[model samples]
Target: MLTKKNSFSILAIGAVVASSLVLFINSTKKQESALPPARPNIIFIFSDDHTAQAISAYGSKLTKTPNIDRIAKEGAILHTNVVTNSICGPSRATLLTGKYSHLNGYKLNEKVFDVNQPVFPEELQKNGYQTAWVGKMHLGSLPNGFDYLNVLPGQGHYYNPDFINSKNETVRYPGYVTNVVTKLSIDWLNQRDTSKPFFLVVGHKATHREWLPDAPDLGAYDNVNFPLPPTFYDDYTGREAAKDQDMTIDKTMRLKEDLKVHADYEKSGIFNRFTPEQKKPFYDYYENKISKEFDAKKLTGKALVEWKYQRYIKDYLSTARSLDRNIGELLDHLDKSGLAKNTVVIYASDQGFYMGEHGWFDKRFIYEESLKTPFVIRYPGVIKPGTQINELISNIDWAPTLLNLTGTTIPRGVQGESFLPLLTGKKVAWRKEAYYHYYEYPQPHHVYPHFGIRTDRYTLARFYEVKDFWELYDLKNDPQEMHNLYGSKGYEAITADLKAKLKKEIIHYKDDEALKIMESKL
Candidate 1:
């Protein structure tokens, strides 16, 4: 009924309206896209010889770690653990590259790592992230790929520690190692490129061997009498291989190896003639009541051994107290700076240490004390608060997970898988088991070099250097790993199956040298 011109005008008007609507929708999308996605600032705090059992959040009754506990309280606590090579240098190398010691070309303490090799920091930097590393990085070679690096040089001294900066210049900083490291980390955080995302690694030299605390913390646990571990006096009977090791707290540890007591030797009227340095060694010899009593009563042999255990626990926990306080300082910094909401905070140790467990102090064996490192992660907004994950994980997985969170691609030849899905509560399938390898052997502590696979239900281990031994523990039944069921009549099938899986893993990792030695021994 309408005229042809009128109908044409109507069609033209409809087209114009449709075009305007499309433009309006496109403009709204552009405004949304212009706003930046909230990328997190990651702060990874690592400690020396901090065992999971020492953390109160992990249900440790020995001491409370309130600051470290903050991370677990706000994020996920990973119960299942990983350590590719348990020694300090190797473990650190594994962390940097997400690869095993062999793959990273840093197998032992003295061995140097290739700086040219790819590391997680480099990848982060490439993706527009500002990276900084402060404190104890025990890798034999100097650090690379970091925008700012202030690291200790070779197990740096506790007092007046020397920190090597990125310019290859070393400067001495006064104060306890832990406190200085935390301060430097906070300084780095304040001065970083705010426009870009940042990744900071704050490494603390705490709770290490020869435990020494700040003067104020010296008397922290002086009043509390620590309860003896159930296996404190274990004879190591039926476990000849483990018994023969030299990691016992009683015999192997030295009094002079850890404590301090008197300020002025001569003024104290005890070893008065000795100089401060000369008297310092003596303080280690006789600080604790048991040690003093042993010396006063002239206790010998077995009686002397009993006295050492009591002294070791008190001093170790005192040092741990100082570590907790320093961590609290850093946590406070994040909160005050308004960074807590957008920061990803993590607290972990290089490897777990023995606190009189199996009557041992050092970590090297595939036992639970050495195998489980404490790991707690807090990613605001992304991770559910107060989450706890018992699934197996490794230090190697750290790199991939961080990369994934930053929306970066994980490179080839990395051994660890991305755990971001687990962190975000996504229902993605993850690894069921973890592999562990310790290469230091026939050396310190005399713990034989070993490799093993650990599953939820069992642990399968092989000690290659000594007797080609095989040890299997039914974790469900023997949580403490008191018994070895490798050749037991009732568990023959179980052992056989684990052995097959172990061999397959070794082959999969392409540890040709290890495989060759294993095959020759077989």
Candidate 2:
């Protein structure tokens, strides 16, 4: 009953319908591919007392931090990333609030960080990002900005450390602290809300004081005899505060506790926390090998000091080895999980530490070694590979930059201006100088409370409270800060100009105590 013309017309109509459906599907696929990710994921890999001198990216001869260097090679590195306060607790507080020590009300390590205050991660949460802080957050109180919080209690032990979770339960994880922290971080990343972007602070307790390396990294740098810094025997002739300080490689760094000279494996201390399996490698390395060699030498005077320096370097670098390796592991996880394309990885330290510079170990002084910290960041699409930013940057800028990167609003009362524009190759007016203030004193290292300003070519500081003396150094000429130019006859005009700028900065920061002391000195 069907005609030949009717059947041909129906077949032609069916072919046209099929072609239209294919075009529509291809268009939708193109549209989806064109859209960029809503927000970038951020991973801030933070460490304690990791000096630029130890990071290979920062031209360090001490050690090769390949994983840390990878960040610098991929993105940008800050040449002058300075701290507002050169201590651990206050530095972390500044990173959180984007404010100085006086403004944040966390000026010392003994005090508690006020978690009720607003933080950048809180802003991220409001903007549809999942936030977490894993590892050593030494702020003395539970964190508030994070959705997932698993952190070390105090200065976390190097081996088999305990992590206080969000449930407020102290759970002991049996592994080296660095590896454990990374594993916990990876676990959080895996278990997190994958639909949303994540902001994670992977805090590490590596390379801190009493440096304890991982078991496999026991004698990593035993053969490498590190060269002493040129200013190692600094006499502290003009600097009164430097002379009175007790934190020296020659004196303060302990024999048994720091260098592990005849360290008791059976003793009830940090070692006791370690399981017998964990103690074997450490005991064998330090006691059976290092301790025996040290005892046999019976080194004295300069020889003994140099020997101690070598041991300290070996232990510290070994500790840092684990830190770097763990970083590599974390990076591998991101790459494997396909998170590398949209994740911004940042590596920085709480503060810089002296590696036998000025014959010192602790970080309290407002010198070049302690004042400046290493900051390297990798953002795959945004930041160009191998970019070097020489602009003067402060740690206070951390929060603001992170906020801006995520397209989040920087809250009011946040002092730091975002350096995000720098990453995007935009020409903007940046800070010409950086301000620094150190408050802890007398008890820990006796560095004496001080406030200072570091310009492109000069560093002007007033050591107050106990010793009301001023120290100025022309950093261009005296890179080692050996010559004090505060009261020198030839540089009166520059000194006056720097003092005026310092006063202006102190007042602008609204640090009443610093202003009062500065005014009194004037």
Quote the positional error of residue 233 for candidate 1 in Å: 2.4
lDDT of 2 at 154: 81
- The C-alpha RMSD in Å for every predicted model, in order, reads 4.6, 3.9
Q: How many pairs of residues collide in each model?
A: 2, 0
lDDT values for all models: 0.80, 0.91
Deviation (Å) of 477 in candidate 2: 0.9
If scored against the real structure, what TM-score would every candidate get? Answer: 0.90, 0.93
363-460, model 2: which lDDT tens digit per residue? 97779999999999999989999988888899989999999999898998899989989987889998887899999978788889999899989999
Error of 1 at 8 (Å): 15
| Local error of candidate 1 at residue 163 (angstroms) | 1.0
| Native-to-model Cα distance after best TM-score fit, residue 395 in candidate 2, in Å | 0.6
